[model samples]
Target: MKKKILYWGILSAAVLVVIAASYATWNRLDPNYTCARCHEISTACAKWEQSVHADVTCTDCHGTALESFNSMSEKLNMVYKHFTTKKTFEDIHLTEKQSLALANRCAECHQAEQASWMSGAHSTTYKDIFMDVEHNKMERPYWDCFRCHGMFYDGDIDDLMAMEGGPEDWHIKDASQMDKPAITCLACHQVHHEQPRGMNYKDMDETSRGALAQKAKYPSTALYMRADKRHMPADKLLKEQIFAGDSLVAEIKDANTLLCMQCHAPGTNHQLGSEDDKTTIGDFKDMSCITCHDPHSNQLKTSHRNVHKKLFSTLSK
Candidate 1:
């Protein structure tokens, strides 16, 4: 009995020691700090530090399963790869799966925005875009479709589709991924974008109020450009010209509306109403797209059935 007790005690002590070692190691290699250790990611860390999400930890967004055995194992694997491999950090980017996972995390804070986006056409799924019978019947799905639709998809159009450029008798290679979102929160917004400083709000005049309102309205509203695979500020992007029937009708001046144009505009063909294009013409030539359509909800006030009735009623008076 005495010998058995001694063995049990020894085993218990060993287990405790192992647990303590692991806890200590995990704390020392905290995901937030561990990410900063890489020289290549230092710039990203610096930008994050200046953004609104400076308080948020790297693990909060990047972690797969927090405080779980799998999470710890993943961290360990990353650490091991960092030390053993020379190309561990080369072209490091969040995968489509990772981006989708991170969208849920973003919803925790921006519930209203998430709900609005999810309710709108922008939150369309892979199946909705790729497997639409009517759309496929009219136009065959191609690699160029992914430039706007499935920008974050890991594989090329060839990898996803078994047959291309044909009579629409096709299916996605990964049927399991059909329901997954083709575009997510990260598709349009840059979470780590920092707001500009040095605004003179001292005067409190009408001009000052206007400037402040404009600044507050568009605090770090950035559009993710698929071509560059990077977030570009809306103001810088809106400077580009938009056409309507061979004429440069809309030189997008409003930064807020520019974000919408990124996806809504014409494709490489540059033709109006081509490939999901919604270029404005006629009387709506100079108007911003967001003038009648709510950006998040996509509700068109002018096009509503009752809009004409309301206008006629007002005019009759």
Candidate 2:
């Protein structure tokens, strides 16, 4: 009986050792090479290798290992499916939940930008935007509403609210989504794209540094238009027509303001200051939307002191 007990104890210890070793191996294989093992994602892996975030691990931005219990199970399931099924992998896209998870990862590197985004109107929650009694009562909710309000949401506007038109009974379909942000950091920025290489601004001449800062391209700056379910590059957004009365006053062709115009401009009518638009006129006619409004924080930088101070402080830093 003593010999039998000793043998079982040794067997259990060996099982535990095997389990530990397997877990370690699983973790070790989470790097980019393991992801590239699947040919479908090899292109993405290659792009990531060339990106500014090349140093960042594949799992850091993509997986929710610590947050979700099903993350490991999901990966295992994918592997199983890949082996057993004949279906070829077309593309891998981030779900709303996965995209939301990236907010924390982004905050890890860009705390100041994250803080500014969180504090702004752009960070408004689904409940704040959709379930507002005053706003809903005034105007009817439609499918186009999600174009700006809940851009990251995978489902249609009908899936969110009950009624369409005036004085209708309304309630959120998913109570859990009430507090979740409709527009997240990924709504405006593309993580996979490369950025301008960091220059020694301090060592460079003031003119050279200023020129570099002005000309440096923000390749990652994009507007995630829910209507098409694709990211429109900030520089390539469609030019919007601004109207004063009957005549077209200006075509907002500025690349910098293009992303902002996606939501801030007038609706289909394309009239300035219509449908929650704050398009400026008079002395501010030539200025871009970003002239007064801080893009991330949405704070008014109208005053010369405030504008120049922020500019000089950024340059000095």
Q: How does residue 172 of candidate 2 score in lDDT?
A: 80
Location of the lowest summed lDDT over 10 successive residues in candidate 1: 195-204
Go through the candidates in order and give each one's C-alpha lDDT.
0.67, 0.68
Residues 147-252 of candidate 2 have per-residue lDDT tens digits of 8777778787778877644444576888898899888887887776554434433345646543532342554467776755666667777777777567787676
Best by lDDT: 2
Top model by TM-score, which number? 2
Evaluated against the true structure, the overall lDDT of model 1 is: 0.67
TM-score of each: 0.73, 0.76
**Per-residue lDDT of model 1, residues 55-164, tens digit only:** 66676676543367866776687668677766433345666766787898888866766787888887888888887878888877887787778887888877887664
- Residue pairs clashing in model 2 are none
Indicate the worst ten consecutive residues by lDDT in candidate 2: 304-313
Error at 309, model 1, angstroms? 17
lDDT of 2: 0.68
Q: After superposition, how far is residue 298 of candidate 2 from its true place, in Å?
A: 1.0
